[model samples]
Target: MWVTSSTDKVLTPSAIALGNFDGIHRGHQKVLQPILQASAVIGCPASARKVIRDSQCPYATVVTFNPHPQEFFTGQSKQLLTPLPEKVKLLEQLGVEQLVLLPFDRELAALSPQQFVEEILMRQLQATRISVGEDFRFGHKRAGTAEDLRAIAAKFGVEVVITSLQTCQGNESEQPTLRISSSAIRQALAEGDIDRANRMLGRAYTLMGTVVKGQQLGKTIGFPTANLQLPPTKLLPRYGVYCVKVFLEGEGENIITQSSIKGVMNIGCRPTVAGNTPTVEVHLLDWAGNLYGKTLTASLEKFLRPEQKFPSIDALKAQIAFDCDLARKILERST
Candidate 1:
């Protein structure tokens, strides 16, 4: 998708979906569908025949905030379900033609409801139609509501579509209904419920980062690992060993495909080895190569065990061997 700032001039009108869309979870899909449906009727560029017949068709744009408004206002560091680049990829896969990542600062946050609709939506984006979740609010401490959006947008000849919140049945009998949201997915991941988080996300929970050098303790014990330095704001599953698939970052024509290798990943401080900080270390099964200075995307499949402090290095090594064998079997079954 063509990405631009909210202040950029729009040459063509757009049918836009607006939200934080941090995780782009199933509920976000409901908010986005109206824009896609409108795009199809308006003739997006991808369908050449339709575009040829309707030259004035509006582009499908997703307008999202960066750093999340909560993080911006509170200045608190928190893990996000999906980072900006990953969110962009997800939106593109959903057939969005353009993305407008608006910077959330004090100035933008100070705009009144009417000013936001007139200045950003109508004047800048040229939005012919706008879609948002029923709970969506904006402008000056969220003074604007979905009802406010409709009234203000109409003055600019813009159409407003509000999507109802989506929910899924709870897995446990105690809780019957659960709203699908980014916070819910984060809670699942923080609790190490990978399956539930994946179900909510519509995909596996993934971590992407550049490989960095570590203490080389894994190599000394016969299982060499590539340590990953992840973004500080990226949310992590509970500290544990997990079944994962690894994809090496590629250059030009040598792009590596996802799930090209199966492995066991440890996400924690190596307590048994007297390590102090949490780290992501992965050992590729039956594979060896130089991975320093390369990026890798690790997709978590299942949680195996929590990080522990073994009595001895030999005992830790033996436990790792068992973890590897278990991970191999799990990966095999998943395939």
Candidate 2:
């Protein structure tokens, strides 16, 4: 996929999907499908020709804002389900051709509704058609609604597709339907409801980071761990130990190992060791390799236990050992 800044010159007309798309959850996929189909038809490659019939297609593009408009306006760091790089990777996997990451600053935030449509959507992106969720809002102070977008799009000879809000069947008996949203997913993660979050995401929740050196505390305790340094804006699950599957890949290399290793991960400030800084540390079972500087993607399988301050180092070690044993059993059963 071609990634370009929004300020870059617009060469091709596009059928764009508009949203923050933090998690690219099922609902986001529903909104993106039409745009993906339109783009696939237009830019059908030789390898994809067998799947997509020959037809004129516009550029398949995703127009999203950076720093999340909420973060920009509120001056507070907003945790994100998918960071910029991860979001780009997800879009590419979904067959998006281009990603236009618009800078969301005070200047861009001040644009009137009409100015946003005339400038960014029309002049900059040259959008032939735009797809957005029903509740999507844009322009200064979110003054523009999906209806406003449709009205403005008509004047520019652009087609606007507004998708209705999507819901998934609830797991509980009392509530039959639950809205599938990024906010809902965030709330689930915040509350350590891994199962519900994964269901809404249509995939396991994963945290990707570069392995960094730590104090080697886990190593001394006989459960060596790879310390991960995640992006500051990345959203983390509730602080605790979790059953996880770890994927390790080389730095600056496209090679990804096919098999994942079962592991136990801790996300918290190590209170037992009198540590105050929060960290993500994972110990892969039966794995032996140096992962320093490598990228590791850890997918949360289940919540094990909350982080706590053990009375002694021995007690902490014992608890971790038990956690690992349980995690292994859980993972084995799943397999």
Which candidate number maximizes lDDT?
2
For residues 167-237, write the lDDT of model 2, one tens digit per residue: 87778742687799999999989999898888888888999999999999999989999999999989999
Cα TM-score per model:
0.91, 0.92
Model 2, 314: alpha-carbon shift in Å?
2.3
Runs of candidate 1 with Cα error greater than 4 angstroms are: 9-11, 45-55, 172-174, 252-255
Candidate 1 lDDT over 219-303, as tens digits, reads 9999999999888878888999999988888664444656469999999999998889999999999887788888888889999
Per-model clash counts, in order, read: 0, 1
Candidate 2 whole-model C-alpha lDDT, 0 to 1 = 0.87
| Ten contiguous residues minimizing lDDT sum, candidate 2 | 46-55
